[model samples]
Target: MSSTEHTSLAPVEDDARLPVADPGLGEHVERYTDTDPAAARRAYRQVVTMFGLVPLLAIAFVVVYFAVPQDLWVPLLGTHWPLNNLLLGLTGGLAVLLVGLGAVHWARQLMSDHEMVEERHPATSDAATRAAFAEKVNAGVVDAGVSRRGMLLGSFGGALGILAVPALVTLADMGPWPTAAVRRETIEKTLWTEGEVVVNDVNAKPLRPEDLEIGQLVNAEPASLFDLNGHDYLTEKAKSALIVVRMDPNRIQIPESRRDWQVGGILAYSKICTHVGCPITLWEQQTHHVLCPCHQSTFDLGNSGVVVFGPAARSLPQLPLRVNAEGYLVAQSDFTVPVGPSFFERDSRNDYQEGDQ
Candidate 1:
């Protein structure tokens, strides 16, 4: 036969079978609990015991959550144990697992175990069949004796209640907002002032204009950072940071109003990244660009620290600098504008009216 005839003949033979065998089902085995009251009662007690333990484990989980400090660690074998995390996770996980296991065990061993075979039927059941299904469900619920088992009901409810404690405890860290002192002294101001000396970050020496060569860039900080009190040390160190770069005067594009802001070829700009406030010092001598290592933000130092590339939204802040009568580099005044990342008030019309100078 040709391939087309053979293919057509194969389908015809397959279609010739009008009926298929119905395997029906095999014999169902009766469980011990089905015939014996004592065995059924024992299974009931075992399921109840597992459910009862869940509430106790949940309570232990709450206790561990509150009592353990977050930083506490214990060495076990060669691996370090985050004991607090380990204990809390294990107790809470076991409580939930036990509750599931108890429910499954009770359904299999103690509740109704009659084997049922549901024959294929039409898509929609008639009213009589629907009523019979509801009746069977109600009968199963009655046989389970869930309403009469006060201990199981109470223990399961308690376990669910105790699980909410960890969520409440975590909400405590949300805060009442920054303290007034922190808001005013740290966030709003920095160590830079009229006479604060600008010191080289590397050797911590005072900077002189003569010390900087053409096309040189130096990471710098305020002298007051070394003597800060309490949290001021970190606060001042973060905001008062500066980057000193020198280029030929002819290569620079200084605004007419900022002509006196630089001493010789040396200019200073805030080292804080405008993108997200990382301390930036990476420099490219030929391009006169200072790059932030965090997100590769590039700023052209010869053009008032203009952002040349990457994600930074604004230019790096320029710090007005001059030589004191004694020849040490000092800030001309506090930054005219706030020095870090942009905020809601920063771009408001009222803030821009104040101007960068």
Candidate 2:
């Protein structure tokens, strides 16, 4: 066809025989990075630098993991946080942000930005057509112009490689292996000793039987827990928790083995639920049952903290109580049964006589 006979570039001719052809695409506008070589190089360097810092952040996260204690707290946003948590959060957050920013900058400034028009086709494709599509995709990958870029490739690899820092450092939690004796001392026993004073959980005052009336239940912990430093205090607190209850002496049934486990009408039992450890404080005055809110495991305090109802399979461990010369409630001994959830490899010696837990 002659040049004049072809369709116009802008507007269409009114003649139906000389119909206007579709405008394939808009003109490719050159970006500053594409037009200026210096700008492009600067952007590439910036991306590589961002990715390079990822490894340092990852290393810092590892250092913080080992250096900072789990219970260590620092002030931020008006709330105390563990030093480990603060550093890990800062480093991990920055590492992720840098990775995202680097990828974005690389795409915007360094990746080839060319305008191309792909003709639309039907969704389904023949085998030969699919093969052609795959070939074209590989060709596009080559056009990406990153395979030969050593700095960019190395930086990206380093960022991804050090991503395992958080995962590896978290494995520390599975460690600090508790030897059988350590396990017995830490998880099974609390700060309660033969004469350790029972203190009010709320006011920290020494508890006496007089402080409670019939059908009254008060949360109590051993006085020795107050002396422990930070993490030790928390661990002891979890196991040392006690619930002191006063009932009519006639209503309380004392086993032959546990005859002297109460002082006056006050009896104490571990606040931790045997089924699944939840700090159980929900008491039933009428039924004399203490309910675990977590799984609704009910233990009858009137009995030997026997599982009276719900999902509980084991009886709550009772702490032997005595009145010291000061007329205050005190522990006769540590809990005879292991406390908290019945984990595997626990002190089997303390299992319930009633049945398997």
Candidate 3:
């Protein structure tokens, strides 16, 4: 034959063959475990041993969750690593990993090594055909020898069950719900009482009218904050914090009813924003605006602390100010309205009655 020409051979007719002789599968070679019963038993033991360790690792996860101190750290890679997080991740991850490796080892050595293929069938089969497929699946599960592997099944169940304990135990850290009085006293009211001296937040000294310059904004807190002890000091100081800003008396907009709330154009409003209660000390003296650093909700302190821009829904709660007997700026009383962010069940009524001063 020429180099470009090919000879055609006579087609052979066989069962389910096309116009050609089929080249079938390769010669089968058995594994050592398949031929020797002892080797097969050893490999099965190896797989079961791997699965058995999964439960031990899972138990270690529980131990690490409770025993390891969260603040404890170790130096590595020029930085400290949290021992609690490290141990928890290792124990939990190794538990799942051991189970996967055991199942893979069992399939490779002890399970059936024979290879088979099926001819293409119709995409949508009859009900009888689907029923036959389901039966084949059940038969395959039985052939995989899981039905006789009681140790693997028990250990797998035990390992998976212990995984839930860590998550459920950590749920206790969310803390208890606030009582009605605790909610009102903590968030709605502050330490500001009648004639409570307005002190500088930095030096803790009282602010006189002469101490403030025009367009000056100072972060302030109630002088009563000095008398409180323990957690009450921080808690009351946070709620009673103020921004005392002085603007030109003619330039400021003081509503007719709240005229006495100012001391020579020096007014104090809450340092906390009504939008999610972020600390707002970002002052724009020229525009008379205070911006929340978290969400950029702007409020006009020169006005009645009105919401001039951004996402703030309500006006900043104004703390009524008065010049006391010592010429020191003092709070006339607590805020007339609730301070901070709004909630569904908050009592919005002004709790400060007319003669409370």
Candidate 4:
């Protein structure tokens, strides 16, 4: 059609046929790096420098992982901070941040500056178009100048390779391989020992058989736990904490093997649930059952602390109890078995029925 005829057919104001105006790409301006070789070299160096710092930060992460003692605390803000965690986080975070920043900086400062719009087309492409698209990708890579820049390639590769070391070295934290000796020295034993008095956890006073009446339950811990401070106190208390309960001797079943483990009708058992280490706090006086509030695992305190209901797999570990010369309850020895949730090394045979020894 002629230009005048096209102008005459163009939609007027408020016409339903009015089309949206196309905002064409604006003028392209050359960057300093794009125009000058010296500027381009400097931009390349900046990105390489960023990538180079990532490897150093990664190395620092590993060094901090080994050098910093886990228990060492430093004051930060108004509170104490774990120095090991602080240093590791700082170094590891910087390493990852530098990698991302370096890629962004490289794309903006050193890669292609020309802009082109991609038109939407059918989703399925013919085989010839697919081949052409692959060629275009290769051409784009050439335009990016990645294959030609040895320093950028090497520095980026080194950064990513060194970053993996942090994860690999941390695998060491999982080991020394939880051998039988390590298990025995650690998870299998507690602060409770022969002659260690069982003290009421709240009052911190020695517990006597008379202190607990029938159907009464008292939360108790080893007297030796008071000697420890901070982490040691919590750690020992978690393993050695006990619930002392007194039941009618005629009503409860006393296993032949554990006959002397209780003093009179008072028995001491680990307060920790065998299912997932929740504390057994809810008490059923008449039934002599103690419930774990966290998961509702019930243990029959009247019948050797066996699992009477819920998901608990093993019976609660019983503490051998006897009266000292002073008439206060004392532990005859550490618990015969591990007390908390079942572990890989835990003996399932510890679970017993009424007739089993």
Best by lDDT: 4
Residues 204-244 of candidate 3: C-alpha lDDT, one tens digit per residue:
99999999999899999998788887567878877888999
TM-score of 3: 0.63
Worst 10 residues of 2 by lDDT: 348-357
In candidate 4, stretches whose alpha carbon ends up further than 4 angstroms from where it belongs are 1-19
lDDT tens readout by residue for model 1, 1-357: 766664434554543674666657778888898889899788778777887777688778778878887667889899888898889888888888887887777788766666678978998989999999999999987766676555655665665676676667657667545565554554557778898899987677999999899988888998878876655677778888898988998987787767888998789999898788988878888889988898999888888887779998788778889999889999998765667776644532322111233
* Deviation from native of the Cα of residue 247 in model 2, angstroms: 2.8
Runs of candidate 2 with Cα error greater than 4 angstroms are 1-24, 69-82, 122-125, 174-182, 228-232, 347-349, 353-357
TM-score of every model? Answer: 0.62, 0.82, 0.63, 0.90
Candidate 4 residue pairs in backbone clash: none
How many backbone clashes are present in model 1?
A: 0
Give the Å error, residue 344, model 1. Answer: 5.1
RMSD of each: 6.2, 8.6, 8.0, 6.1
User: What value does the lDDT take at residue 21 in candidate 2?
Assistant: 67
CA lDDT scores, all candidates in order:
0.78, 0.83, 0.81, 0.88
Which 10-residue window of candidate 3 scores lowest in summed lDDT? 348-357
**Candidate 1 off by > 4 Å:** 1-21, 35-39, 121-136, 172-273, 276-287, 290-312, 317-355
Provide the global lDDT of candidate 3 against the true structure.
0.81
User: Which candidate tops TM-score?
Assistant: 4
